[model samples]
Target: MNITKYVLVLLVMPFLFGCNSDDYQYPDKYLPNYNFSIDIDMSLPLYTPLQFTANPVYIDQAGIGINGIIVMNTGGGYVAYEASCPNQNLDSCSKLAVDGIMAICPCDEAEYNLFNGQAEGKEYPLKPYRIQVTSGTSIRVYN
Candidate 1:
């Protein structure tokens, strides 16, 4: 009975302590969630820039993301983030513009790294979407 109790406590202890309260989660107060799926072909002329590392593109297609979606090639792989500023309310100025390896929000000049979607000196990170490399020449971004 003592050995069986020890085994049960070992199994139950991990489940009770596994959850970390400090885990960072992007807040949804500012940018509302939208369901969208978009695919890009690297062979296409418009998306040819994505073939290179650190090159970011802003797709302004309507109803895709809150404002749009920013896709970038991080050399080793691809990452996609929402194009709106995570720290600000959704406004015309909340749209982020691609500048070099970072995306700059015109509202307050909050720059976010496109590679990892982290904001410069800010607690909130740019909301990221799920990306899948469909093939050698194609990628899909969805949320």
Candidate 2:
């Protein structure tokens, strides 16, 4: 019985730990970093419609460092994505347009889901920023 137990232990040990390979692979960086801040006042006509699953709003103000930023209400919470193409460099044609839940890039016609920033049929996703509700009347988007 002891010999049988030892053989069982030896079999289990390899399966328990397996191989420890430190080498791992990751995808390459494909987007530029642009600093920006956006303040949403719900009382403002421009942002009033953003409650949940509504049309996304494109914000263009002095403090938004790049061309602009896109803000949307995902029906659960708020999400914001950089209004630029992740697969391509910044250019006039690379700016994104929102149609329903997707952000479309004019240059390549690549589409990314606004809720999670995952591109459709592509490995690269949209560059995302951080957003939080400051109050019942306001939201802040920053990177």
Candidate 3:
């Protein structure tokens, strides 16, 4: 009986932990180029008192690679993050809503601090981009 049990374990172990030779390859066609920039009009303010909305705005004349970007103003300064959700990597249901001092995603309720881009409820934070604000009429977002 012990010998039969040993044989059964041996047979099941390999099948349970089998290895595949096919290397995991991410489709290159779907991956967008990482480096890019966009220009957002600074005149339009989405939120009030705190002054600016967490929702992403589409800027057509910014540049290639980055047609639309999310701009967040946390009162202290402006923060920019990728429009894509970190949890599911989907662009459709991902958006930032100002909750006190943090940004909350409506889809999964994944919250992030707009001040630092730190995820509140989940481990993974929202992907942040580089923001350059001038004293003029526009802000530049880069990744």
Candidate 4:
């Protein structure tokens, strides 16, 4: 019975200690959660720029996202990110502006790559949204 108990403990010890508790914490910890779903029609005049590669559009409609959503056409596919800077709370300068394929935070000048939402030497990456290509001319972004 003692030998069996030892074997059981050995098996469970790895299960308990092998997992990293910090894994539960997300990289984008500063941004608050918001529930929203928005669809963009690529054929529309406002969204027509997204049909080309590296053309990013900022949809600043109220309640669309934390600040808003920055939708980009990477040529490979459509990518959407929360326009709020990930490294800090939402502020006047937290809104990201499209600078080519990079989103620049006006406050800190932190640049995040639109292709992957990563900022160089920054701990947090831009918050991403789920993108569904409903058709050749439409996409749904949700979070």
* Candidate 3 per-residue C-alpha lDDT over 61-116 given as tens digits, one digit per residue, 9 for 90 to 100: 34433224456666567776554455654466654555565656777887776567
Q: State which candidate, 2 or 4, has the greater TM-score.
A: 4
Q: Candidate 3: where is the Cα deviation over 4 Å? A: 1-33, 44-68, 91-102
Which model, 3 or 4, shows the larger TM-score?
4
* Best TM-score among the predictions, by candidate number: 1
Worst 10 residues of 3 by lDDT: 22-31
Give the TM-scores of the predictions, in the order they appear: 0.83, 0.73, 0.50, 0.81
What lDDT does candidate 4 reach at residue 79?
90
Evaluate all candidate structures by whole-model CA lDDT and list the values in order. 0.89, 0.77, 0.57, 0.88
Query: Which of 2 and 3 is ahead in TM-score?
Result: 2
Residue 14 alpha-carbon offset, candidate 2, angstroms: 24
TM-score of 3: 0.50
Ranking by TM-score: 1, 4, 2, 3
Residue 127 of model 1 has an lDDT of 93
Off by over 4 Å in 4: 1-28
Q: Return the lDDT, model 4, position 129.
A: 80
Report the C-alpha displacement of residue 61, candidate 4, in angstroms: 0.7
Pitting candidate 2 against candidate 3, the one with the higher lDDT is 2
Q: Pairing residues by index, what is the TM-score of model 1?
A: 0.83
Per-residue alpha-carbon lDDT of model 1 for 1-143, expressed as tens digits?
A: 99999999999999888877645355798988889999899899989989999888889898789889999999899999998999898998999988999899899999898988888687778998888999998999988
